[model samples]
Target: MTTPRPVDCWLTDMDGVLVHEETAIPGAAEFIAALRESGRRFLVMTNNSIYTPRDLSARLAASGIDVPEDAIWTSAMATAQFLDDQRPGGSAYVVGEAGLTTALYEVGYTMSERDPDYVVLGETRTYSFEAITKAIRLIEGGARFIATNPDVSGPSQQGTLPATGSVAALITAATGRKPYYVGKPNPLMMRSALNRIDAHSETTVMVGDRMDTDVVSGLEAGLRTILVLTGSTSRARVENFPYRPTRVVESVADIVPLVTEFAPVTGPEY
Candidate 1:
């Protein structure tokens, strides 16, 4: 067993660890407040590329979490950073919301439908057949493929909704090219967040609800991982995975005291 380090920074998932479907989870507010009050560097990460950071911030605020826009990091931002690093001033034919497109634009990427460098796929409420068709044609025309995340379905009050991975699969079936998914479980997304905060993986803790994505990615990135059972995975299911988190708790509420006890105070508490 790898010994856990004291937490100096944090990377938490938005959906399960902090909130669930527009509702803030119990104790989530206290945990975030602790982080902010302690002046510990942290970022609320999400794989959903449907909304920009500002949009997410506003949504979280409405849900009772007072996270600022800059404190949130999305897969869209990661994808844009990846693309910008790979090819500065590149062009892409994007099929996503303002979240993905805006990030790309900020990074100096141009939206093009004519044989662009890449065909980027992301989350959208309506996956237009016309856009998917365009993406397929572009990929067949020799453009590379990229997607924000591999989540096939997302939770909703009504039911499961087809997500980015499902749409990416459809494109793959036609083009025979798998996209480079840049979200959770990729490790790149974790690395990107760490870089954003200038935090080292050795001193950072990752809190998430899924073993396949959050725990694995954090472990690979050399961060202590915490699995919260407030969302998708259950207690019994934790053992099913070959890997395990540093600790497993019932929810974010349960971890607040642990964080307080373990977190080193960098500044005087208010």
Candidate 2:
């Protein structure tokens, strides 16, 4: 067997690996601190497209995980980046919240309903039927479809909430146009996040909780992946999937020491 590549950069999912439904996961703060102190390139990734990075930072801070805005990479930002690269300064009919809108605007995208170039779907607490209807019409009128992520539902303070994938399905059923998703499970999101940090896949490691979204995406992106059993995925469910993460840990707490003691192994060290 070949020796494992030494990890010099890190990409981690925010929801399960760091915070769990408004609460900070065990050792999340320590892991973040270790990353910052290690001088290694690191980014906190999230499929949730509802909040901007700044908003997310504040929310994480409230949970005692003091990650900065620049350190957080959301699906909204990835979607914007993909659109910008595909067609810079293009227009879209968006059906989401401020997070998605702000990212698009920053990337030189215009919001319009009059024959827009694309109909972008994102996550929001309250999805409006009128907005979705307008999106369907625009899509039928020759607009391409795009979405932030494929998560059909997300955890909320009260309970489960319908997310971007669910709404995108509604639009697809109405217009017969499926959206190209730009978030987790779509390796594009992982590549985009890596690009943002100027990190290479060979030296990067992705830490996540969910087997479907986190591990699969990282594996497809050619990054070593770690699956932590502190969120949506359970230890028993991991074996059901054909693909496996590079490493599986009990929780984020188990990963803290790894980061803190990370050292590049060279020559006969293996």
Number of clashes in every candidate structure?
Answer: 0, 0
- Give the TM-score comparing model 1 with the true structure, all chains together: 0.95
**Positional deviation of 22 in candidate 2, in angstroms?**
1.7
* lDDT of candidates 1 onward, in order: 0.91, 0.89
| Residue 69, model 1, lDDT | 90
What would you estimate as the lDDT of candidate 1? Answer: 0.91
| Per-residue C-alpha lDDT of model 2 across residues 1-270, encoded as one tens digit per residue | 677677789999998889887889989999999989988889999998889999999999999987889999999999999999999999999988999999999999999988899999999888888998888888888999999999999887888898888988888888888999999999999999999899999889898999999989998999888888888889899889998887788888877777788843222210
Q: TM-score for each prediction?
A: 0.95, 0.96
Model 1: runs farther than 4 Å from truth? 1-3, 263-270
Please report, as a residue range, the 10-residue window in candidate 2 with the lowest summed lDDT: 261-270
lDDT of 1 by residue, 1-270 (tens): 344457889999999988888889999998998888878899999999999999999998998888989899999999999999999999999999999999999999999998799999999998999999999999999999999999999988999999999999999999899999999999999999999999998899898999999989999998878888998889899889888787888889877886677753121111
Q: How far is candidate 2 from the true structure (C-alpha RMSD, Å)?
A: 2.7
